[model samples]
Target: MRPSASVAALLLALIVPAAALAQAAPCDGGSVFEDRNGNGRRDAGEPGLQGQRVSDGERIVVSDAQGRYRLPLRDNRSQFLIKPAGYRLANRASGLPDYWLNVRLQAGPALKYGGMPVATSCRDYGLIPERRKAAGDLDVLVFADPQTKTATDVDYYRRDIVEPLLADRLAGRRVADLGLSLGDITHDDLSLYPKLNAVTASLEVPWLHAPGNHDLDFDATRDEDSLLSFRHVYGPDTFAWEEAQANFVVLDDVVYQPGSKADYIGGLRPDQFAFLESYLAGVSRQRLLVLAMHIPLFDAAPGRETFRRADRERLFGLLKDFPNLLVLSGHSHTQRHVFHDAASGWQGAKPLHEYNVGAACGAFWSGVKDAQGIPDTTMSDGTPNGYARLSVRADAGYGLRWFPARQSDSDKVANPYLRLYLPKVLRRGSYPSRGVFANVYMGREDSRVEYRLDDGDWKPMRRVEQPDPAVLAENARDDETERLRGYDRAATATPSAHLWNAPLPTDAAAGEHKVEVRVFDPWQGEQRMSASYRLLDTAQD
Candidate 1:
């Protein structure tokens, strides 16, 4: 039936306004602006930052001339900024960088550990202008596998690792410009995220983290839902950041298979590759491209594939154009370097370098406790518990140095580069079969190691494939005892990648002789250490 003009007009007005409201309200969007007053809000007079890049995990969009951007709403995903050089994001009170916004679901997956929280309206990002040094000066603090299992483990990390670094910062010493934790932030207990973040935040640097196997939600039935807790706490599991020296990408390489026998494998998802292909195309090849992840790209053991080979080939193909590349990973707990060539599907201009960093909680914080109530926690490969310092320079060059957790001030010969083991006494004029061993912490297969006795001619030390004698000795001690050494016994020794051996010349003299050892470190120049051993006459013995 035909209605009157007034009734039809009223119906048209009601339907039209409702449709307009539905279209006008956007689910995801915000403005990138210069926070002139240092506050995180965009007040009057604050200008929008033009040409800034924002991403919704897969797709990237540039801010318009007015510094505004809008992306299609992605359910249960995160949007992050590709921070530009010379500008910095303000850190949250928890010391996490304010670079990402969470687009969460009203009701996320119900997991054993409480899943993600409801969505928040935190799209607006405030950037502060920072005067950075010329092209390539950057320093980063690198930590791996601080996999604390309980409150006590957290306390150990706080006292053993964080306190020393915090002391340096408190004393007005220079700290790293950026910090990275390569995963296993917690040991299966997702609730410890806040406590761990608090300790790391005390460093006062912008920190980024990769997801490790331990940082998973076991109740999820699929790989896609594995990192719900991680994303909730740490934002996007895959994202990128930029500096004058390098373009950094953090990827979630751990692929969970809820019901599979293998449980999980190391590989990138298609979405991660999509983001990489889109973003890397625009990235300048002149700058270093640094990829950080929890699992390594290379296989852990021969003939056994740890990471998916097809995914690695695709990733390498995307990275072929970049000349300067570095890959950082941490999952093995022990440290080593791997170079990928053509055989490994790396067809770059040169071999690809991967540094598998040592764990901060070495051997899961196991071993006898010291006087400070901290575990010794030396790794099975004989690498002491420590962190890495990465220095980048202007010419696309970088340097890496490892610092052990405990440094002794009173020892006459205190060198952090390597640890030495030698017998205190030997029979004079014997067959000279006993040898001195050195564990060069950062040593490579091609490293040049030499030793000199009593300041005599320097003799070369041969690299050996064996367990570190020092660690083996400690293992023996633990085995000979019945009582519990600590929370756990030290890990049994494994063949080290950097152990060197040299025969001691007991035939030289009957008195004490000083042995000096040195190695030419590719990054840290020359490092030296000294120890003394005595030779006794048969009658005197």
Candidate 2:
């Protein structure tokens, strides 16, 4: 909802002086007032929300007893409310939660596409009553790279990805009370914001967003203006919110330098580092800190630094005091888990866990189409296009389960967690160098994976840092195909971090046999999943 004239005038008065002062002057904002009528205005009888947390995407401040807050803005900042438990944000015109206010005061060169206007005052977020929740047992849905570039891709997202999640996440009871979209929300198309917002609104939860490289404004000439459209729509590019026992920080780690077109780099800006330092100082060391960003904190592609190392080391230093921490990112379109300890620049008691989540619109909606007319956009790492369900316990422990996109109406795999690939025809005693492969989508480096052929004893599988053959074959098909109809081709297959291989047992009987593969999750010990594949014997045939 747009602000009323009176509200806008009040905000203007609060902002004009700050803008008139030194550009770097500490810009502060208005109060967190209660909207008695659900309107985005301060009507009579409505009082301020006192002692609530407010931030300028950097340092946080608490509202006084009068519900007034002052933010020390350093750049093009967006003010956001750390929505206290039991309070939910009022819906905006585009159906996004009204938890953020764009307070863009500094201006840059005008572009073909518009940028944020001068701000006088930051808007106050209106809240309604909600079932108060703690930082306890909570389920949150995480979608990486829902990078819809066109209306059709958006349609595929709604049909293939959103529908199933809506049913699964909303079924029986709403265990998933929160959702997070790990950026690339669109593929450089700012116009698609409304469409993306509309579909995601169906999830029926206040969703948080982090900006990706693709979300940058190509026309902007400076880094600060790169996310003008994004910030205008999704509020702060970086902000923090508190859950029961966790502090969730969504950061805009994609730094864009505009020229012919915006070139992007992955790393936190100086202000982000300063903000994190200040924010971390007040946070309890025991609380779980989950930092979600569009780009990963570590380089995934070989010989290429996806994220800057110095920035990561600085971030690690700030996080040293926090024993319980998790980093999440979603730009590689591949699924893997990375742990950082002292050796990796983290000086924490336990290694920091970061889930480089798979993309929702896997491989940018490429590859062949399914019967449902949706692209079979499997990731280059062989992980299916899916979302993550994260369960954070009251004790600060967490579990993440990868949910693959529903294949088709007739799909009936009892254990659909892992993908097992077996040899089509193996000679009775011939051992192939690479036997069978199991792409445990959520598998970690230390995960216990075992396989048994037919009724033989379960033998452990070796964790191999290699690309999944299935994805390699899929990539080959795109390269070999005569005609491809998608907007883009699938990404080249990269070495998967969660894959396991086992040589074929040379002593197996010459007949049809089943290969059962099991994965015992390392972090989540209770989660044990299995999938089976049919193996054929060439000798018998």
Candidate 3:
């Protein structure tokens, strides 16, 4: 479970996950898998990923206005192919795109899209303070690995995503004053940074970047040019910047500590650590210490170890004194939030909420064509490819709403895709593994939920009444699950989003199925979402 190119290439060379592949319809395109931001679901906005080319040997296509693309491969290819030169793929987590991907092809044509999350396009960085004692309302934009392997990838991000963000700024939204890229901005092309920054200049924001494995020189006779090219483009590797509300501390954790430059881990070297300490010396305790690293402090399922124990401990020690420390990281492009509950996390009392933001590239932008024939770049975890806007509220509360690329084109603030409703699960209690659990949010409590599994009978999930503590405490806690659970629930912005609990009758034969659930709200038409789960081997019959 790691996000590395070698692992991806190796997995592609070996196991093409059956779950991620599908059959095909002849030259109908060998099952092109692209980010179909159509239907206002996950399209790109100012920073759209346009002009990406997808081919499966027989078919070829490009991205469109919806930040979508399509392609068809001839023969028995199980997966729709990805063109690696100009544009690599993206890996998204909970709701943010990072550096991993999951793709499905049409019909029997199978394609295996695998890899560790790359800190290429989606990234992190410390904000360089522009003013002191100034208006405290500060908002920083975080872009993870875009992994522009070629000029096209850059163009895609420029047209599909960044340009829209610029438009948002023009619209008076107070777009983030500062910008930070996670890593892998350039895919081995040390020469791409200046041009990349040039396009990023569209936002009219001062930006900072981190180096990823792809951005490094794998084979250098000497270490002088380790990140020499990077320094030439974005300046020092590890440093601090200031915004009004938060004191940003960035660390270059991509130190190739073990193998020269070719093979390294997500680790920070002595010099980088020293820079962090030196930067912290001047930071005040009241100011939030936001550590933005290219690699995740934790991980997603396929996302493997990046930030190790020693580094976690070291970083924890560094920020332990500060009461407000926010860790913004990406690498595991699986959008999920892990709040350092008192039970699980690195250290300290305050919950360290780390986000495994999904990829803008959506599993390397791999998948079959949708109604528009563009790649359905929804990641394996089911998160659609998209960017995230993190607003650090003036009240010291962080407010985040992940905007699907498709949403920027429309004016509706909340769409059906953004709602979540789960059933009541016993608080602090475990349920029988085989029992059925329900999550329903049908706008109103009276709306119904219809469920079906692999030709199984349609089942009705009953709505039960119960007191929801999390729901009640949401708005009360700035850093509560409300800001974070959006990924798990897709929508339902308010605390009334999700309600989950298991029923006694949820047993089945040990097998797999397409469990599809559709909920209808009074305002919107019926909305459908699906999840696949294998019956636990130890499940009680």
- In the range 289-378, model 2's lDDT, one tens digit per residue, is 889998888776557767788888888888877878888899988988888767557777878899999999988998778677888888
Using lDDT as the measure, the top candidate is: 1
Instruction: List candidate 3 stretches off by more than 4 Å.
Output: 1-136, 170-173, 221-224, 257-262, 299-305, 341-345, 368-375, 413-541
Clashing pairs in 1: none
Higher lDDT: candidate 1 or 2?
A: 1
lDDT digits (tens) for residues 1-541 of candidate 1: 9989989968967866855433223545588999877677888999998999999788898888878988655666788989987788887766798888777646777997876777746477788888666554789989999999999999988888788788668989756788999999999999998999999998888899999999999889888889988887888999999888888999999999887889999999888999999999898777788999999998988888899999999999999878899999999988888889998999988999898899999999999998989999999988889888888886779988888875522335457689899999999988888889999988987899999999999999999989988889999999899988888999889988889999998778689999999999999899899999999888743
Alpha-carbon deviation at 5 in model 1, angstroms: 22
Clashes of 2: 6
Off by over 4 Å in 1: 1-29, 120-122, 132-136, 408-413, 539-541
1 or 2, which is superior by TM-score?
1
lDDT of 2: 0.78
Model 2, position 135: C-alpha lDDT score: 41
Candidate 3, which ten residues in sequence have the lowest lDDT sum? 118-127
TM-score of each: 0.92, 0.87, 0.53
* Candidate 3 lDDT tens digits, 398-440: 6444555455636466342433323223222234443333434
